[model samples]
Target chain A: MSKVSDFFAEFVRRNGATISVYLFTAVIFWIAVLIVLPQLYMLDFSFRFNLPPSKIGTEEDVHTLKNYKYLLFGAEGNPNAFNWLHLEVFFRTIWAAVLVTILNLVICYPVAYYMTQVISGGKARIFILCLILPFWINEILRAFAFRILFGLNGPINFALVHLGIVPEPVEFIKADIALYTGLAYAYMLLMIFPLYNAIESLDHNQIDAARDLGSPWWRIHWRVVIPHAKPGIASGCTMVFMLTAGALAAPQILGGPSSLWFTQVIYQWFYTGGNWPQGAAYAFVLLTACIVFVLTMMRIFRVSLGEIAK
Target chain B: MSADVELDHLTIRFGNFVALQDANLRIPAGSFFSFLGPSGCGKTTILRAISGFLDPSEGHVRIGGEDMAGIPPNNRPTALIFQNLALFPLMKVWENIAFGLEVRRVPKAQRRERAQELLELIALPNQGEKLVSELSGGQRQRVAIARALAVEPEVLLLDEPLSALDLKLRQHMRTELRAIQQRVGITFIYITHDQGEALIMSDQIAVMSQGVIQQIGSGPEIYENPKTPFVASFVGENNAFTGRVASADANHAAVETHFGALRGRNSAGLKTGDQAILFVRPEILQLGAGTQGNALKSKVLAKEFEGFASHIHLANSQGERHISFSTSQEEALNISPGEEATVHFSPDRAIALPLGELAHE
Candidate 1:
């Protein structure tokens, strides 16, 4: 605690008290208004049986575990039963996030490697420009763009039909393909930049030495490049997995009627079903799952939080 | 295993810029050869060519009498120790040394044993399990060498692997590197810009400048009997005199300079009235001369006192030419700055060559 106080003193001494106070207050406001306060309210709301203002005339709704019980089991004291539908959607969301993260890694590794190591000078600038150009548009617009591209009569279906690869225009929006594609494209820059930063700092001579020592192409990447990129991979995977798991726009626009995402269900509970407690409970569950996943990824990849920051 | 390396009329060009041109060289098997030159001299480029990182635009590279055309660096029977040493930072020392064997599908136990053997060879037997980053610079260098040798290639290429070391350690590694090369008995093609390193370690030295090889010979021969003006001024410090040839002969030439006529050995054959430069090493100049051949009459301008010797700077009587020579402290006692001095050197110690580019200080 004193270390933090000392750091605060030093910061104020350097920046002066007024400016320091402004900066500190700005951070506190940001955390409280945007992050901490909302999560705290949600935590409080999750334990309460929320009732409509018109119905609660004399007494307030009491705190209870009934909302959580309904979420975990189905509707009451039948502990032997499970909310299989809700649980399946939650697990599927996590699985799809993991799959998309892996797919982005596989596709972007070579592109990042080529951009950082193979391309030179102005050409490298050009490559970076192309990667950044699509992201200039707002993310929702990009998701909508993916919707058009994967729609029933979109360019992909048109091309497949024209090439005679498919006899008919495929209903891609009726499946999970559109959602996964939009999510992958949405988080691509987050994956590519970190990977590129790590790979670019690598000494080219190490690759030469590996090859000169008779290492084939694949072994060089497996032993040298990937190990060097472990932190980048971990950070990219963690971010993409969290974002994809909690994603709302892409799934809402691209998912079929049967493909109900966890976030959509949470939204329905709060706004449409008029069950704020259940919505808070479901959101907390997703947050917990994401935190567990981030920790697991860090452990499996053998990367520290500090290294991922690099 | 060792093999002879031959570059047959090699030429490499990047667009209009020629990095290396018509470089033909034959390195005998088991010989430790070096390409010595300043930066941008194409020594590393030639090394890259021989190691199969690059292909010559016009000719062939042969290792052990087998053509290396169309072969990539991995397929070539040569290993290169990069300038940075390039040890894998993420791997254990043993894993780094055994990486080559691992790629070849050598069994785990065999790879471990081989890595251990190489660790012993490099005098770091107990350091096999340490990460490459944990070792000192010299230790890392040795690990790099051992890692390259694990594959047992026919030839080893080193691109100034000692350039990163401190002065003391660089000097120490010179002997260690030479000892390792002798022990391995492989054709070692070392590239360095340091003349001391080349002179101390190589059996043969190729002096390069720009994109061309100026001379190729044993160290002493290249130093003492330089065939060109550039070689004479480059390999070591030498006082040069540029003038028009007054008289010519097969063995000797007399050049008329600002200080009148001076005579020296005509190593680069010159006709009468040809432009030439005379080069004399400082150590060979006789102070307070007994009137030997090719004597110079001048006055001392300044003296730089080194521990064992004093370098006396002098100018001709006309003050149009400058000469400098080293003399022992004992002999330099009476020769202070601004005093008259007579210096002489034998014609055999000086070589006159057709004037060309001289080494820049």
Candidate 2:
């Protein structure tokens, strides 16, 4: 028994480093299985008419090009069923998402600029905390609050009527425009913070030098500050654009029936339509689009991923 | 005259604490003026006020005759090379120099040409393409200066720019800076705590302490004739003998101290029965029997041999303490750590100021 135990102890001690590395790698693999694998399997499921669950692990009795075919072209005129696989929906979602991202940047830049640079240091931190405090609450609560205020008999309409700006109460909720407003509110901080961090790090001496040399204030910002702020603007835009592109909640709740989103179609294909393969293909397409956009941005910056590590 | 940059009773306050109380100065242009003091002595504040970085609470800072009340630091016809040097780290040497011109939106070709000319003027013509971070400490200093002067302002503000350099480099740069100031013929207002730098480079030096100007004069004037106790101790190191005045007249005063009655020439500000302190520079004290003027006979307490000078500590048989005197190592006094010696100094060399303890109280 002593011989056996000594042998086992030596074995354990000799290969400890390799054993620990294997253990860590195994844990990481399973974690990826739990989170990211499901996403891939779910995408495959969304792309098929009725993909077998076995396809996640083994390619058994599962395949389809019809979903991509139907998405790219149109669903053949099957007069009995609803024609939801329309390509125009993809274009509209992307267009609205682009608009939302632009709006997010436009609103956040000035606010972040003022917060980071104009306010003194102690108050700047307080202002940042105040902007972020409301975000700790559920996004759903905030979205519903907007719904309450913008509803038909909401305070917004009441205020307009009392102030005598509008002759009648206007319907604002469940509109496409309302969806844009809600997304902007939801993601304003995301776009603002990185920019604030970037612009705050800019040396004040540079600005003073520019003005001392005869440049006006506007020209200082134009010639110096904005150029230096490009990295922040690019990263913030990417964050907002990618996030808004995948956004489903704001469009689902605040959007009217005419404002149906592309993600809803993907959701339906996965849960209700039982078209796993088609949904996976659609998921793959959106993933590819996001990747292409980000890569294109990198190419435009002419800086390698390694160079822009921060 | 470009030399007269005048402050008309400049008073600066941060909320309630007055940083500068009725600070009035007239810095002659085309000459190097230095504000010298210990840290937090309102020297830098006065420099900033003149540069238009701080608005004085109740006075005018005027260059020539124009009021510089609201003119921004950039808008004022002045250039400040900050203590940190503030050379843009991301820019090349020439680019950093041309930043002022670039702010004017000078054409790129012309700005580069002018920057190269400045780089050559500073004797660093080949360093134009190097990043500022790549330069040595002294080189970065030159780049900061070249960058400031590229704008050709009437007055230049240098806030202890050489304090960061090594001693040998700092001494070398003093000559270089003074030469450049002369070459440019711009009013240079330099601030520093190091007395050597101020003494060597400044045409006029103001010795300040605790928000008040203690004394202002040429280097030798401030050194040889420090009016206040603070000025006497601060301008150059000095040993003080504290005692009450035994007798006084218009030309001189006799002080009764632990060291028998030592009579020294009065500095024109004392009365009898008043407590006073006698100031004597160590170098002015000679160490020989033949060098007797105000001969102080005492026993040597300690002796130290510095390469250039020797310090001899002598304990007065009549006083409560010892006195230190320094002399050249070449001319030898044969006094060791425990021997009787008589150190000599002229009566006129001693400056008598009111007792500092009573003044502080």
Candidate 3:
């Protein structure tokens, strides 16, 4: 406790009282008003029953677990009738998020290695600019661009047909390929930056030493590069997984008629169905699952939260 | 078993710049060879070429009398110890040593046992489980050597691995490395800029300058009989006098200098009227006029007592040429600064050679 006070005292001494007070108050305001209050209100609202307009201030308005139970047994119908549709969407969202994270990792690791290790100086600068230039456009615009690019009559299909690789244009959107591709592309920068930061600090001599000692390239990456980049991998995986799971834009813009995302369900409950409490309940469930997934990944990778934070 | 390495007239070029040029060398099996030079002297380029990290633009590299062209570094039967050691920080000491064996699909038990044996070889017994960061600088250096040896390559290349240690430890490791090389009996190719290290640790030393091998010989031979002005000045200290060869012979020459004509052995065989420089080692120059050989009179500028010996700095009467020589402590007791002195040296101890680039202190 004294250490905490000492830290604040040192901060105040360094920044002066007025600046310290202003900074501390700004942080408090951000936590309490912007973040904590909204989450707490949603949490409280998720537990209460959605009462009718006439039940305002009446005894009928009470806290209940109906919104939570509704996720499992829909509409309070026959007891055995399960809400497998919502459950499946929930699991599918999680599985898709995991797949997207893995896909992004597989694509980003080699690029990050190439950037940090192979090409250097002015070439490295230009490569970074090329990577970040696409992100300068808005995310929605990029998603729509992906949708068009993956369309049946898109340039990709035109190339495939001209090349005689396929007789007919591939239905990429209907096959759910466009959605996965869009999600993977959307969060790719998040994965690459962490991996780049990690791999950039590695000494090039270690690779040479491994090669000199007769290690094959694959074993070199497995035993040296991958182990060294574990923390960055964990950080990237957690960020990509959470953002992909809660992602709404790419799924809505690029998803086909049959594809369903859990976020779309929450959006429907809140605005279309006019049920804020149920929407909050579903959102909270998604957040919990995302947290659980991150923890499980951390356990598997054997990385600490502190290391990821670094 | 060790194998001989031969660089058959190799040259390496980067773009238009020549990093190494038409170098030919033969390193005997189980011998410790060193390439000694200042930075950017192409010593490392030669080492890399032999280790298969680089390919010579011309000629070939042969190991055990077989060409090594097109072979990748991993396929080459050579291991390199980097200057920084480059031990894997994430793995235990044993795991780092066993990494190459693991790549060969060796069983886990045998790998661990081999790692233990290597740890003992480096005198780091029971330190197999500690991370690279846990060891000191010298310990990490030993670990790097042990790791390279664990692969059992025909040859081992070291790129100044002891350059990072303190002076005392560097001297200690020099003897330690020589001992290790003898025990293992592998062809060791060592690269360094320190002449002392090259002289102390190598069975043969190649002195290089500006991507060219200036001279190659045993340490004592190179020190006593340097063929070039660069080698004479670089391998050790020498006071040089610039002059024109007034008289010449097969084995001796008389050079006309500002201090009158001084005679010395003509190692480079300069004819009359040719420019030459006479080099005399400080240890051989004695104070006072001598009855034999060559002598020069100069005014003493300063005298520095260096415990066992005293160094007297002097210049000609015109003060245009500076010369320094060391004397015994008792002999120096009679000398003081600003005194006129005569330094003498036998012609046998001094040599005249064609003028070339001299080493800067």
> What's the lDDT for all of these models?
0.89, 0.79, 0.91
CAPRI-style docking class of model 2 based on DockQ? acceptable
Worst 10 residues of 2 chain A by lDDT: A78-87
**What DockQ do the predictions score, one after another?**
0.90, 0.39, 0.87
Between candidates 1 and 3, name the one with more favorable lDDT. 3
lDDT of 1 by residue, A48-146 (tens): 877777755346767788778777787755656798879889999999999989989998899999998788779989999999998899988988899
TM-scores (chain A) of the candidates: 0.93, 0.80, 0.97
Candidate 2 local lDDT, A1-310, one digit each (tens)? 9998797577668779689568667988988988789987766555456536654545555566777766676578765344444556776777777888889888888888788667868898898899999999888888787777787788998999999999988878655667788888888888888789778887776666566565677867766777667677777877887888788787777777776677887888778987667777777777678768777876887545643345
State the lDDT of candidate 1 residue by residue for B1-361, as single tens digits.
7999998999999899999988888999999999998899899999999888888988899999999999999989999999998889999999999999999999999999999999999999999989988999999999989998999988999999999999999999999999999999998999998999999999999998888999999999999889888888889888888899999899988888766677888878888999999887888888755565577767788888989888888885457335888888988998987778888778877888899988775
Candidate 3 residue lDDT tens string, A1-310: 9999999999999999999999999999999999999999999889877777888569987888888888888886645677888989999999999999999999999999999989888998899899999999999999999988999999889999999999999999998899999999999999999999999888999999898888888988998899889999999999999999999999999998988899999999999999988999999999998998799879987999999998
Off by over 4 Å in 3: A52-58, A78-81, B316-322
Interface RMSD (Å), every candidate: 0.6, 2.4, 0.8
Best prediction by lDDT: 3
Query: lDDT tens string, model 2, B1-361?
Result: 2546887888889998878777677888798999998888898898788777688899899997789988887788888888888677666889889988887778999999999999998999999999988899999999989988998888898999999999899999999999999999999999999999999999999887777877789999999887788888887777677788888887777777666556676875588878888877887787764444466677778878887778788774454335787776765456676667877677678877787621221
Q: Of 1 and 3, which scores higher on DockQ?
A: 1
Provide the global lDDT of candidate 1 against the true structure.
0.89
Return the TM-score for each candidate structure. 0.96, 0.86, 0.97
Summarize candidate 3's per-residue lDDT along B49-92 as a digit string, tens digits: 99998988999999999999999999998999998889999999
